[model samples]
Target: MVSDRNMLANILRTELQIHKSSFILGSHSLICIFIYSSFIHQHGGRFHLSPLREL
Candidate 1:
C-alpha cells in the first residue's frame, strides 16, 4: 500500500514537472498548479512534493 502511494506520488510529480513550464505561461494553468500543489501538500506531505517547492 505504501509503495503504491509512493508510485502514484512519483507519477504525479513527473507529470507536474513535464507540464510545469507550460503551466507558468497561462493564468488558469497557474491556478490549476496551485490547486494541485495544495492537494499534494495536504495529502502527500511536503517531503513527497518537495521538488515543486523549487518552482
Candidate 2:
C-alpha cells in the first residue's frame, strides 16, 4: 500500500512538473514579445530534467 501511494504521488508530481514547464514556456514567450518585441531566437526558455529523478 505504501508503494502504491508513492507511485501515485510520483505520477502526480511529474504531471505537475510538465504543466509548470509548459506554463513557464508560455509566460516566457509572452514576456519576451512584450519586452523585446519578439521571442528571442534562443533556447534558454526551456526546462530540462535530469536522467534520473528520485524525488
Candidate 3:
C-alpha cells in the first residue's frame, strides 16, 4: 500500500512537471512570435523573418 501511494505520488509529480514544461514552452513560443511580428511590422513587412508566414 505504501509503494502504491509512492507510485501515485511519483506519477502526479511527473505529470505536473510535464504540464509545467509544456506551458513554459508555449509561452516562450508566443513571446517569440509576438516579437517576430513586431519586428516585421516595424521593418515595413520587408524582412520576411518567419517561415510561418505562409500559414
Candidate 4:
C-alpha cells in the first residue's frame, strides 16, 4: 500500500511539470520561425526587406 506522503509527492510533481510547460515556447521563438519561413522561402520571392533591416 502506498503511503499518503508518496501519493502527495506524485501529485505535486505532476503539478510542477504542468506549470513549467507554460513558458516553454514564448512569443520570441514563434516569431523567429514565422520570419524565417516568410523571408527565406519561395526561392527568395517573398517579402523584400531593405538592407538596413535585420531580424
Prediction-by-prediction clash tally: 0, 0, 0, 0
Rank list by TM-score: 3, 2, 4, 1
Task: List, residue by residue over 1-55, the lDDT tens digit for candidate 2.
Answer: 9999999999999999999999999999987556443222233544334312411
Best by lDDT: 3
Q: After superposing candidate 1 on the true structure, give the runs of residues whose Cα lies further than 4 Å from its correct spot.
A: 24-55
Highest-TM-score candidate: 3
Query: On a 0 to 1 TM-score scale, where does candidate 2 land against the true structure?
Result: 0.57
Tens digits of per-residue lDDT, candidate 4, 1-55, equal 5788899999999998877775565666887777667666743765655422754
Query: Candidate 2 at residue 25, lDDT?
Result: 100
CA RMSD of each candidate after superposition = 18.1, 13.7, 4.9, 5.8
What TM-score, computed on C-alpha atoms, does each candidate reach?
0.39, 0.57, 0.80, 0.42
Q: Is candidate 2 or candidate 4 better by lDDT?
A: 4
What's the true lDDT of residue 30 in model 2?
Answer: 89
Clashing pairs in 3: none
Which 10 residues in a row give candidate 1 its minimum summed lDDT? 46-55
Candidate 3 lDDT by residue in tens digits, 1-55? 9999999999999999999999999999999889888877877887774646643
lDDT of 1 by residue, 1-55 (tens): 9999999999999999879966667878788788777766876665454555755
Candidate 3 has its poorest 10 consecutive residues by lDDT at 46-55
Where model 4 places Cα greater than 4 Å from the true spot, the runs are 26-54
